[model samples]
Target: MIRWGTSAWLGSLAVGAILAATVTFAGVEDRADAGRALPAPTLSTPPTSSPRPTTTTTTAPPDPCGAVAAGMSSRARLAQLVMVGVDPRGADDAVDQVRAEQIGGIFIGGDAVGLLSGGALGSVHATASLPLTVAVDDEGGRVQRVDQLDGELPSAREMVARYSPDEVRALAHKRGAALRARGVTMDLAPVVDTSDQPGRTVIGDRSFSPDPRVATAYALAFSDGLRAAGVAPVLKHFPGHGNTTGDSHLGSVRSPALDALRGTDLVPYRSLPEFGDVTVMVGHIDVPGLTDGRPASVSPAAYALLRGEFAFAGPVMTDDLGAMRAVTDLYDLPDAVLHALAAGADVALWSSGGRTGEVLTRLENAVASGELPQARVDEALRRVLHAKQVC
Candidate 1:
């Protein structure tokens, strides 16, 4: 690990971020039997010839996952890791990108339910080539996306503080079921961040508990519940996003020290099982030894830490690419895609923007330039397909 204050650290951080964000799934499997674990579904490996394209429909629609599995070429597959935004007011270009770019997925803002339900989600599902994983931050409290119409629930801290783990489990199960009914497949939830900082209201009540053990228990329960409801639960802000004074959505954030991260912060995430079939969401926070002061979404050491040390084999996604200030201020759409893939990320996400198609084009160019490895692209596609089958 490079010292936080050293100049040598900058080079490693840049390279790591680029690679980690480029590499990075679909799924609906039943886990309704309470604690019983279900084996995840397998994604299709690359084929010599692409499969025949499926037709779209209103009643049956296309098997969104199947279309994505077949339509993406090797280079396009590499580009799919990027999840860019679309105009919340409504736009046709996003649908066009879904079809032309064969995008990996999309991120919808908290207020996008009307748009998503009206036509946006349906358009992406029916037209996109790959199994597009539609996601939102519906973690309840202030992060609830669907609550504008569905009504917000209690904060995680409040829920855990007032109720039992089983109560949180029930709430998560209900939330997941609701999302699934509306055609949303992934919920970026169960925060799992352990905030120990004083008056740090940003992550406050949203996190399950300040104690890693309690937070871990609640997170596992929430994940199990969501999975049972056929909605994938994403454990977020990996290695932990709780101790930061800065909010990544607004600007860059760094931990006070490595010790602050190792103790209470990462306890819940590190304590979880292999989390083999889970989807882990990376945050934009900058940590010294882990992210080397770059965002975790595009950090090599961050990737190595999550995949190599934590042994979390599930799909990895970034917090919305459209929302993070670090990414928005530094590069254009395609450059973000390249940097993310190179950093070992499986998904580059955005939740608000009109340039989603342009972003996709940039990713395509990078693949053509051989800046990213084709093998990594293939692995990401495989994982996506597998997730859809098993999760």
Candidate 2:
């Protein structure tokens, strides 16, 4: 476990802030728990498809973890790793939780407009020491949440059908700007799954194409737009959830063999480096060939693949752990949060259930008892602070 003296923390914070500001001022422009059963292998090994060329100007800010570490208590820092959903009716309660528990972020869903309007979100923001990462699922089509407040945008599939890559980027810029105007700083979008199968339901309209190259093109374009608009974009369902017929929200889902995944499921992620510090959301689907029946969200092997093979260095987040039956049916919310963090996810997203105070308490106890390592917590906290700094 890692420990730091108060003086060391303070010094590091000062240095971190200076480095962060220097990097920014320089204007450097860069351009589910367990699987019930193993699924049958479907596709044969296909030819490799290279990602389409795209440019991005953003780079990660200098590490700000020390600044957060020096300023907050352990409980407060741990809270930064959890993202909870809020109800419009209980907006006041949510604000209280933010101040009392030092909750890291808030997600608006279902009637988001009602919950966030009239300075409701601003009221919550007023309670935090650091800027909270206010996020929404604004992927367009059926997955949009806040668009109900403004107007509708086309789905990923529809955008592909009607617009060029440049057009899609323009639309995403407008959407991202609109979300930012409402105090939202992050967008969970640009579904990168490459599912072209005729009957695929979970990701049918959300994905850009069945072709990996096309998906790569649109993913980068959408991310660029979001970054330009000042809202961070998150690439969803990592390791690919488009090929599966099962919905993780309902039950367990499985992927094909490891070799087959390279050509299809892994393409969009391979192209992630081009997008700078964009976040990646790991799904609940199990890949038996890779993880040996453990859900990707809770399996160290899956995260190792992402960090070791793909070289993803940004914040790694989990899909809604409380809402999905794959996890809820197996482990309690707190236990699931521990598993996800231990497996390398930096953010444990609770879109439906789980109280922020209770989650923070459990995480604290786990760390105290060595069930979770302090180093792990520190690393996750660093990534979380890094994300906030960039936003």
Q: Which predicted model would earn the best lDDT? A: 2
Q: In candidate 2, what are the lDDT values of residues 21-87, reduced to their tens digit?
A: 2222223222331445435545784423345445445555654556548777888878889888877
- lDDT at 250 for candidate 1? 77
How far in Å is the alpha carbon of 10 misplaced in model 2? Answer: 16
Could you tell me which residue pairs clash in candidate 2?
A: none
How does candidate 1 fare on TM-score? 0.76
lDDT of each: 0.67, 0.78
**Segments in model 1 whose C-alpha atoms lie over 4 Å from true places:** 1-71, 87-94, 110-112, 116-120, 197-200, 274-276
Instruction: Give lDDT for model 2.
Output: 0.78
Tens digits of per-residue lDDT, candidate 1, 1-391, equal 1010112212222211111222112233434655875455456654223434444333433444445446556557665666666544453655766776666666666464555555456666766544566676788777787786566778787778778878877888888777776657777888888875543476877888888888888888888777777777788887678888677767888865666777877776675573335788888778876677788777878877888867777678777666578677776656766687777777777676556557656666766778776666666665665565411
